[model samples]
Target chain A: MKAWLRFSTSIVNKSVISDIMKLFDIDFNILKADITPRGGKMLVEIDGPQASESISYMEDKGIEVTPILKVVKKDTDKCLECGACVSLCPVEAISILDDWDIDIDNQKCIGCGFCISSCPTQAIALME
Target chain B: MKTIEEINQKIKNGDAVVVTAAEMTLIAKDKDIKTVAEEIDVVTTGTFGAMCSSGVFFNFGHSDPPIKMNKTYLNGVEAYSGLAAVDAYLGATQPNHDLDIGLDYGGAHVIEDLVRGKEINLMTEAYGTDCYPLKKIKAPITLENINQATMVNPRNCYQNYAAATNSTQETLYTYLGTLLPNYGNVTYSSAGELSPLLNDPYFQTIGIGTRIFLCGSAGYIIGEGTQHFTEAERHHGVPITPSGTLMLKGDLKKMDSDFVRGATMPSYGPTLFVGAGIPIPILNEDIALRTSISDEDIGCKIFDYGVPRRTRPVIKETNYQELKSGKIEINGREVPTSPLSSYKRAVKVAEELKKWIQKGEFLLSNPVDLLPNKGQLVKPLNIIKPPKMVCDIERKPVIITHPTDPVKEVAKKLVDNDINHLPVVDKNGKLKGIVTSWDIADAVARGKTKLEEVMTKKVIIAREDEPVDIIARRIDKNDISGLPIIDKDNKVKGMITAEDISRLIGKKNNK
Candidate 1:
């Protein structure tokens, strides 16, 4: 199971993620991360039968954990392919194809919502 | 040169070789302009962008009592009802006032609903008259129920537009999309080589009455659009400044929702995404050459939008090729670029236009009139205080005299009021001329005592609503110390002097 985790400045310095890893037999992979002295966000893929339990345990420790059902979903019917969302993506997930259609790689999207609000047409949405 | 009639005839016969501007560039690389012009009868061009000046006019068949709709709403969005009793014009950018949909739906959504064959809630309010007794009416309406539904756009398909970037330390949300703080990204809105106006840069083959593909339907160019600046600097007839726009009119019933979309920008309200395509008849070699223009040849200036002024300074002049490359160097930093206009949709529009022409469903029309090759210079709006003269008698009594009055009396009045200028008026109190002390002295030297003879006949008067800066400039240009302020009826209202302007400036500086 994959999820996006948000940590506040106080919790960011703490080893809550490592504590969760040790408490549960869960293998975690940091797909993407952005950590500042203030606070940060991370996209992690947690593997194990107790992935749900590990996420719950992290929530109990004051770490915000949101499970990722679909990272990003683009409404093609509403999309004008204006490329307004391409540059704001932290990862190079959104790109213009040869035909100039804006393509977003859901695999590379970290669900940052940077492209969502940046989109003038409001065609891109972050799906949890 | 081949005429549009000849090209249309070839199109009717399914013998006209038509290609999109993109396809024509490839053909032009292999063959000369003359050969390409001879082979191709028409070249299709297109643009898909957020055209804010778009609207749809709908003629809903009269109600039972035929109420004059003074106010209207379509799916909670207000539609302009100033046209006729039942006719209404729904602007693309009108926001949904009644619905708290987070500004997601608007007039464009109503248009899309109509295009998609969905019923829209039509509500109108009118003051009940004797003949039209109904005051308020609410009903569901569809495109089929309407007598006429046409998309009338004042401006579409700009030849070129500015690329936008933010220089400020904070992120800015503008019509150019989101501009990240500290020049994080640059955004431009144009289809580059695929744009319709770019392909017919000079308006040689496209003008009034020229048929076009508008949102998947056949439409016509009505005239040169609003803010159409044709004389902007050009490279190969392609404008570097935003110029050569087109006014388009088409039936909304025939349009597809896929091409015409309602777009809502965060905090900017609603705007229409219009897909426009114009097929240029290869009338001559020049037309062929113009159609073959590529992204490398078309260029525009990147403007810094952080200045928050109409006249923002240009950061750099860059071609469409560099813009399309997705990254540009701005202030020594590698800034990513995004296009607000969709080239894919533009290409799709062009291809669809070509198909329509090939199938004889569309025909090109010769221009009824040509757009002027030149445009007037655009001046920035000067911010100045509105002219408000002190009409109180304590400040300064306006020295005045009738035109038939003696020049000696005007001179006496000027001296008595301790003023340098006096306004000469007629019996009806209309300002006739202005007589200065120097003019009165000159007239006395010439042995003329009549006020009309002494007064300056060519007087540049300032209006009551005129800006102070413009009046000041007039005073400076004429080398005059004062000007007579007049009302709309030409009656002398008051007088403004250079001293008064300087006093106002001093006051402003103090603040």
Candidate 2:
């Protein structure tokens, strides 16, 4: 199961993921991480029989967790490919092709929803 | 030097060579302008950006009952239906007023849907008359069913524009995209090198009746755009303060959905993304030089959005090269920059236009009327004191309220007097604070009953004898609709509003 975890500034220094791994017997792999003193966000894939239990434990420990059940989808019918969403992506997931078409990498996208709000055409949506 | 007619004849005969303005830059760097002019018959220029002033006019075929649409909405977004019985104009910026997701849908979306050959839900209402018996009509309409759908814009491509940055701590969401707080990023919106007006800076080749590439179809320039300031300071024939603009006309049926898109700013509502291209005939050396202008030569000032004024202070004057570099130095800080306009699309448009000319599918037309060289000076409205009118203190007593007054009573007094503002004063007639209708409404919503709790303690006041111009400027600068006029003793005398200033201006104009 893939999930996105948000860590507040105070809890950012804690080894919550290691604690979860030891207590729940789940193998966790960090996909992407953007941690700063202000706050931090991490996209991780937790694989185990107790993945759901580990996620619940993380949320109970004051860590915000959202399951990665959806991927960013671009509607070719409505998208203008203006690249307005290219700069808003925190993970360089949205990029402009050689022909000027805006491409979104589903694998790189963390489903942050930042590009969805900034899109003027409302062409990009997080689809389950 | 070859005339424009000769260049057009060569293009018509497929004997002329054409290159994009961006390509012309590289060609001219190696050769002289005269040589480039003689070699290239046409230089293509383009701009792809959010054009909010764009709209489409539709002549909906009459229904069986022949209904006259006075009010119309396409997918809950309002369309202007005041032209004729069946004719309507849908502006790109019209919000979906009645829908909860109104901001997400607008006239631009309707046009895009139409261009994609999709049926649109149209709802219209009209008063039944003797000739037209229908009162209301709701149906699905498509481009094929409509008689005529023309896109007429008051302003299309601006020659140049200012860069916007935020110096405040809070993020600012504006037409320039999101401006990060503390000068974190800057955003600009011009196509720079590929822009039409930038290539033909003096309106040399582009004017009324000139054909252009509009949203993947051919369109024509109708007239000068609104606020076309041709007399601004110029460098290499391009004005820094958006000197020239174009009024364009095109057929909606011929436009492609790929070039024309619907866009919604979070709080600013909807706008249309327009992709346009124009071909400049290289008739002379000067025209070739103008088209060959590079990004290094085109510069725009960076304005601080924190100032909150029409005349924002210029922090730096940087060229498009620095602007496109993704980071620029502002006040010793290297701030990230973003462009609202798509340069990639703009280049694609220019290249496509060049291909059209090279294939002899497109030709150039001479201007029916050239734009004015000198722009009329915008005069500020002066504060003219009428001989019969006296100072603010000599006027009728202003409506006042006490701090001890109940919120309900203050609200009632405001409604009864049809006034939105009231100055709170003491028993000795000294001003204490002020209350507005917003305060009363907020108090009512919050279930507050005391006037003191709802009123603003720091009141903005104006002197009785102060010049109306200064007061009006102050009101405008502060974004306040009105201010309370006070005497020397800090007593409330009267009030002045934006309406009063407008009325004074109207009276002066009448005189």
Candidate 3:
């Protein structure tokens, strides 16, 4: 739970930190989110179900994931069968039309969302 | 059974608790609890925790940039506090701070003495204690970006003439010339420093080398070494037409080297323009607009409309009543009075008719081709074509004074008029020995008592037909004002001075 809290960089105020840390009675180290020019996204993973309630508690206190979620299409009927998106798709989720129909390899999709937004049509959806 | 008070007793004994404002309000029935909660609330918690899920959402609530953690100065002590304090002090003590700052920064010490005192000091103190409303967000500004604009001002050489002796107008021009090469925009006025009159805020930052061009009645101190150029547009309120006009070169090679494809001579008035056929001659419409009138209309308007404003009818003093009565004397015969109202009315009608005649004829005229030779619109006062061809004559008019005229009065007048020679003339207006500008100097040098006491009557004389160069050599050798251009009887045709040579040959190399 403390490790998950360390990944969420929302409380910049020292007073807020002391108050919230005292309320939960937990000692946690804080880190700044790695904000790239391309985007800034804070990721947290709970290893145990016991940490779920604490994660929910932190969420309730105004800690957020990536502020914006971009929805886009990767594979659709607009494909000219050039296979450019397929080759450029880092996760290999985009595939050429097998039988004149595009197939999205959903299991292979890393949910990085770049390919979805780069597609030329409203054919791919990034579920938030 | 344990009552609810027993559970509350347990909570008070240090059980885990989540106290909200509503529960705190119920506890706040006791003033002591209310005071305790108020003290504990160091910062206000946001009410829109769910709505403002992200910092971007907070930005959507207001267009201002997000208040990032790095923005805080020393644990939320905003940097604006110090800056605001300074701005407040400036505003209170100097309500006209924008204007005051310019004067102070310009080193205007007198203004400081006038504005600074005990009252301002007290106001500044009072202003400091007041709170200033914090702006939600202001765009970042850099000093370099702020100074990247041109400032314009009018300049009067007369007002600051004493101070300007050390100040160099040439330096101002040179600086502007340097900046022009770098494609920097600069501003100057034909009127005199305009920033104060225009209430320009950037006067202080405008720089010492800022070029100021005053073209008209800027009340110039005559000997202050101030000179202005003749602008292509006469709209600068001064009649300084270029002494020599721009001419197109006929030599094909020279033409190609001299001007670019789009190059054309700057035009003035209604004149015939000839150039390489590539870029044809343009009318006044081609120039910068303002008082731009058609080339055909310029001559008529200037000669007819503008001139008549000064010229008046020659109404003889004796005939004033007769002219007012609309009567006329024609060939020694008196005519019956017409029904005109007054002399003013007759003059007005005459002026109108003269304008009609001028407009009708003058508008159709064009300048004669002065090709191969650059033209000048010379005034008669500034030109003299001797009746006979004379070569190498001195350039200036020689002054001849009367030998009997009081030398003191003549010398004083000569000095006042800025002329050197005073040609001595008899009562009959015949020539005599010339008093050179240096003659007065010599009289002063020798400390002569009077004009008759010490006067130089000896002088070299030349005929009107003498080659100017020969006369020039004699004048130069003798170190005199010049030989008078006399007739066969030794009467003054005209007097030759060094200025005559300068007027002719000195300007030959110009343009």
Candidate 4:
């Protein structure tokens, strides 16, 4: 069943990420955060069976993950063309600003906190 | 009148000139030097070995001559001879700066009180001055200065006094060395790399009878750096004997001399001197002996052979990723599967993943639920399908004659390998009788003439349409191992057994 746990890059940092994964024993992939829009939270997606299991695991650690919210994709209209996020991308997930304000490379991004730390204008964040 | 060699020879012979306190008192009174040596042995046997194991010692005193005095003494003459012997032993045992030494407190007191206090008489020189302030000392008071008003001879006079200042004090001694009143702090933790012997894990297992010499770094690690007539002074300096500068005899002499090579000589100050006969080899082997230098043969041989460095054990970690993957071949094509996959085929991949996670083949952040993803459950073999009927083998009949019987007879009369029972019938075939292996057994047990009488009877059976649970219940209630499979026409078709039921539930007799 291709089941994987997901995490938001906002709260957890890369330093403690490996330790947390080892501690929980969960298999997951990281998805980059899209923070340009105002309301954005951590996004974790899984199939029905694994989704329930992941939620319970998070709950056990007192991390409430109920009433799940939909992942909010970034809008193309808010193009500032600042090109500030390109350098901040740890996994090189953010593309060069040309015709578009910002383009995301989903494959390279590990959904970590690099872009969050680099965002001077606080424009980028993970959407859930 | 005796030379240093002659004195050393006397001490080696175990004879020391002892000058007692009373004799010293008389010498102070008479002011004589000639009769003192004659009255006491040149080297006293009583001071053969040093008193304490280790600590700093000081000597600042002088002694009276023996010409005017006729009696012996223990005051200063005995200790000086002891000091000389100690230095000899230290020079012999640890020629290198390898040995930790004990200090002579008596020597320090004598030097400070007798030599500096009486001979030099600093108090007398500064008596008329009011500029010098009164100083209070917090150490043990062993000796007090008194009665120095007599007109003194050259030997007893303060002019011949030499002061070993704080800097000079550390270097003049070796084994029984001591630091000045305040010479930095003391370290109580492991020193250096903490020699291998003390750090060896198997050290405790060594038996008491083993003559382990605590030598080299091992000696210093275990030894508290205490030796009689020796002190461990933290300061650095050159080694100077009473007669000559041991460290400054030129390159050829220095290269050949082991004693002066490693000796720490203070350039600006005196280093600590330890003068004990305990060698490094002795210290390495006999931990008990090294600690107790007070033992009779503290300087004697502690080990007949030298000890070699011990090797440390190595540890390695193991990997079992291959066995855990459980890769199997399907039509010569390799596919990885978990051992638990065979138990539940629908979630084979999920089971494999779970097994890998458990074996640490892959890291897992949390527990996961198995996903179906259109996975199909493996079906059981058709031969062992659920029972469609319940029949008692003992109740069914075996018909020997008649083919034109009813359809029930026709159905039960078949000579099939799967069917072991049959219903007997007359011309009408109106449920006349049944036959089975048990019927024949009963015929034999009852000593019946033939199977005909025993086989004539009623059949205990259920319809084929009955649920498997109901059929199992009937078999359990009847206490029979097998039953007949009957259709709605009241005719037998097949048979069932406990073995078949057991085979369906994943049970195997071989396993």
Candidate 5:
């Protein structure tokens, strides 16, 4: 199971992540993280029986935790299909179709959210 | 050879052999231009891309009390209200006045919304006059309520455009979409052979009043577009760079949202993605020859947009064939290429136009005036360097003042020396500030007695040996009529006024 974690300024520097990692014998992998001294967000994949409990532990540490539901969604109405996000997509998940409209393959997408940010019209949304 | 009228007659008769520019390319592969010209009546073309130089002018019928509106805004995005009362021009790229919400919604969205029959927040301000007394208005307006909604794009239908790539270490966001750093990506926007101006490379058939497809609706070519490049060198008949632009006009009410969309570039702001196309009337073999030109034959310079300036270095010259192939090489490194302009949509537009012509719904008009010949020099806006220095032009006595001095004393000194400008100096004769005749008049009008109260405190001073041109520009830009000339120690040595610069021009011209 994948989980989204937000580190607020108060608990941002805490070593509770390492504490949870030690407490749980789960397959843990940090997928993406953007951090500053103030605060930031991170996406992680944690598998095994203690995944849910480890999330609860991080929640108690004041790190906002939410289960990763899906990778990204493209709002077709807002997309101009200009292909501004195609070259910037590292996974080659976003592509232009024969009709010149954009197509996003969630299976190929690593949930990096680069397409969501590179989109000119803010057409892509990360699924909560 | 068939004339435009003959093509129109055939179009109305439902027997015109009209095909798309894309189809024409494939047909021309087997047949020659002369044979194609003899058979085809018209070759339709299309392009859908971000046209930043696009806007709609609205003429809202007068309100109950009527207002000579000088400032107008639609959905918080300001419009150019310089025209008659209640009429305003909303540019496509004009961002919202409310910076927070406006980053997404702007003039382009307003136009798209208006076309979608969505109600807009129409706001206006006026200085109440006798005949037109309404001071302000804030109301909801729809396309149905406005008297006129016309899209008048000053520039569109680029003949061709250079592809853009970045050589820098960081990603670059430009009109050519997002360019990856270190030549990681290349982006181009023209629709190659399908481009309207490219098919009519010499503009033999397209001209003023030539009918066209604008936003999925009928429009007309107005004239030469702004920054219309007449001087670009050509390969065969097509330009190697961005050239020939069209001034376009159409009824906004007839436009479809599918063809006219409001889009925003992540960090680059808003632009209107307009779907446009034009039909080339096969009047002669030349027309057929131009239309037969294909993507592979067209070449475009790839410019390094990494250097942000008026002119960027050309990376290499490549053609649309390689560009559409999805990759190209820069500095011997493989770089992916993307088209910000959708060729699929361009083909769709061309098909739509072709269907319209085949169905006898649209007819071609003979150009009232053809587009002008090419080879107008692409001139840069060069800032001329004037060859005279302040000390070289001649000198005048330094008009000095003290900070604590009274306004009357400065007025007396100005009147005695027949000067209107005075540079305020300190006890050690260092330049402190400046005061003008206008300052004294302002002092009396505001009832100020102290010179410092009326004098400009943060003075703009120039050096004696500096170019008079630089000092003259400084004075003009600062909105001050004069500037104090000081020495290395900051002591006021002299003063140069607008009048002095005017005199220097006369002297230089005479010499």
Candidate 6:
């Protein structure tokens, strides 16, 4: 299970991850972290039996945890297949196929939200 | 050479071998051009790109008492109502008065909404006249009410376009779309090989009255489009820059929202993304050869859009094959590339057009007149001012020198007058040659004392009536500091040096 965890500016300076490591029986891996003194979000993979318990614990500790079923979703009906998002993917997750249809590899998508903004039709949306 | 009528006859009989521009490229590579020419009858091409110079003219008929509407607004977007009482032209790029710059609703949106069968508010204001008594009117209108909703796009279907990238530190929002800073990404708008104009590069078959698939409906090439510059640099019969465009006209009421889209280019206001295609009749081997040129052969110049100027400098030239590969090397950095034009829609347009022709539902029309290949030039809009002639600029009197004068005397005159050029005249006072300081030094160094030996006989002279700009160009072209201004009789009129022009400019600046 993957989830996006956000910390409030007040709790940003605290070592909440360390607390979770000692408190929860769950195993986790931080997929990506973009944090600042002002506080930001971190995408993490939490696939232990106590993943839900861990998420609830983070919420209780003044952290917002959103379960990530998918990093980005595309409404195929609205996609114009203009290739506006093909190269914006730093990890080469999105591409235009031979038939000119957009193919998104969520495995490679780091949830940068570049494709979401680059799309002219606003078809691609960040999924939480 | 196969005649257009012959191709039409085949099309009518459902026996014409037709293919899309994309298909033609495959066949072209496998078979010889001559074989391809003999095998193919017509090649259909398409492009779904943002064409800014698009609009529609509507005649809303006479209002209640038929008010002479001098101003008209459709859903808050201003439409040009400078024509007759009820006729107005709504441009695609016109921004909505009420909306912000980003994704702002405009006339293009109105057009799309109308095509989608959505009702739009129509408002107008005018001074009451005897013929038209009503002063103001506001009404919700749909595609049903308008008597004439003709889309007369002055320009569409660009032959080729520049790929833009930003080399500056900050991002740039351009008509090409948003270019990330430091050559972050490249955006190109042309469909390359699938583009109609690239298929018929010379506009031999595509001309006035040529039938086309414009925005999902039948359209015609009314005339050569605005900024139809055919003189752009070519690579394999296709332009490497913004060249050859089409002035298309079609029924806006019949167009589909899928093909006729209202697009907002990031922060750069509104523009219509039109889908258009032209079926080229392979009347000759040359046409077949041209239509088959692949994307690898068609090149697009990448320009740095960081500089806010009309003429952006080209950073590098790369073909569509490289551009489509998603990465290109520029300044030793591998920058990613993207396309603003929908190639999928372009293919769909070509496929749709091919289906129409194959089913005998659509027939190709012979152009009444061909597009102009000459005399059409894009005259830049610049500050209007009169030309200043060489005579207008203050210059020194002609320092006369006879051909019989000694080299030492010529050098003395040059040194005393603080002048570099002294025109050497013959016995008849007609200008023969000119001696410069460099020439004097060369004469002394070469131990040649004759005035004829020192003086350059092949003198490049400037005419008094010549425009200052022309003289300046001549000076730069010749790589000289000065020139002797001469009259019709070849007599030295005056001497205009680069220094004199600079001095005059300096004094003018002081004032």
**Which stretches of candidate 2 lie above 4 Å from their native place?**
A1-18, A21-79, A86-111, A126-128, B376-511
What's the CA error at residue B201 for candidate 2, in Å?
A: 0.8
Q: In terms of DockQ, which candidate is stronger, 5 or 6? A: 6
For model 5, what is the error of residue B431's alpha carbon versus the real structure, in angstroms, after optimal superposition?
41
TM-score of 6: 0.76
Arranged by lDDT, best first: 6, 5, 1, 2, 3, 4
DockQ of 3: 0.00
Candidate 1 lDDT over residue span B1-511, tens digit each: 8988899899889898999999998899999889998999989988888998999988998999779899899988999898778999999888887657746888877887899999999999999788888999999999998899989999888879999999765577787888887788989998888888888777787778888889988899998888888678888678887987888999998999879888876666778889999888999998899999999999899999876656788999999999999999988888899998888888899999999889998888888887665754555566585444334212455557888888778777888888887888887888888888899889989999777777887677776655676667667767889888888798988788888888877877898
Quote each prediction's TM-score: 0.74, 0.72, 0.19, 0.15, 0.74, 0.76
Query: Which residue segments of model 5 deviate by more than 4 Å?
Result: A1-29, A34-41, A45-70, B383-511
Interface RMSD of each: 1.2, 2.3, 42.2, 32.9, 1.8, 1.4
RMSD of each: 17.5, 9.7, 41.5, 40.0, 12.9, 15.5
Cα lDDT of candidate 3 equals: 0.29
- Candidate 5 lDDT (Cα, whole model)? 0.85
In candidate 5, position B404 carries an lDDT of 97
CA lDDT of B455 in candidate 3? 54
- Candidate of highest TM-score: 6
Predicted candidate 4 versus true structure: per-residue lDDT over B1-511, tens digit per residue: 4433443344445453323221233442453334443443311000011111221222323222111111111122112123311110111111111123221212222222232223322210111113323221111222243221111001100000011111111212212221121111010100001111111112221221211111000011121111111111111110011110001001111011101111111111111111111111111222221111111111110110011112111111111122122232223443221110011111122223223323333221111221111222323356565443333222333333332333333334444423545555455533445666555456557676443465646455545454555556556756766555656554555555565555544433455
Residue ranges of candidate 3 with Cα displaced over 4 Å: A1-128, B1-399
The positional error of residue A77 in candidate 2, measured at the CA in angstroms, is 5.4
- What are the clashing pairs of model 5? B230-B376, B231-B376
Stretches of candidate 1 above 4 Å error?
A4-16, A21-43, A46-69, B376-511
Q: Each prediction's Cα lDDT score?
A: 0.84, 0.82, 0.29, 0.28, 0.85, 0.86
Largest DockQ belongs to which candidate?
1
**What lDDT does candidate 4 reach at residue A22?**
50
For model 3, how does the per-residue alpha-carbon lDDT over B1-511 read when each residue is reduced to its tens digit? 2222332343344331222222223343444533433322110000100000000000111112222221211111122123222221011011122343321221111112112210111111112112432323333222122211111112121110000000111111110011111111111111111111111111111122211111110111111111222222222221211111121112111111111111000110000101111100012221111111111211100011111112322212122123222233433543222110111211222232223222331011112321111122333343375422353443445455666666578788788768766666676666766776677777778886456555566656666655566566567757776556767666666666677766656665583
Give one digit per residue, the lDDT tens place, for model 2 in B335-374. Answer: 7676778887788789888888878888888889876657
Q: Lowest-scoring 10 consecutive residues by lDDT in candidate 1 chain B?
A: B386-395
Chain A TM-scores for all candidates read 0.63, 0.60, 0.42, 0.41, 0.72, 0.68
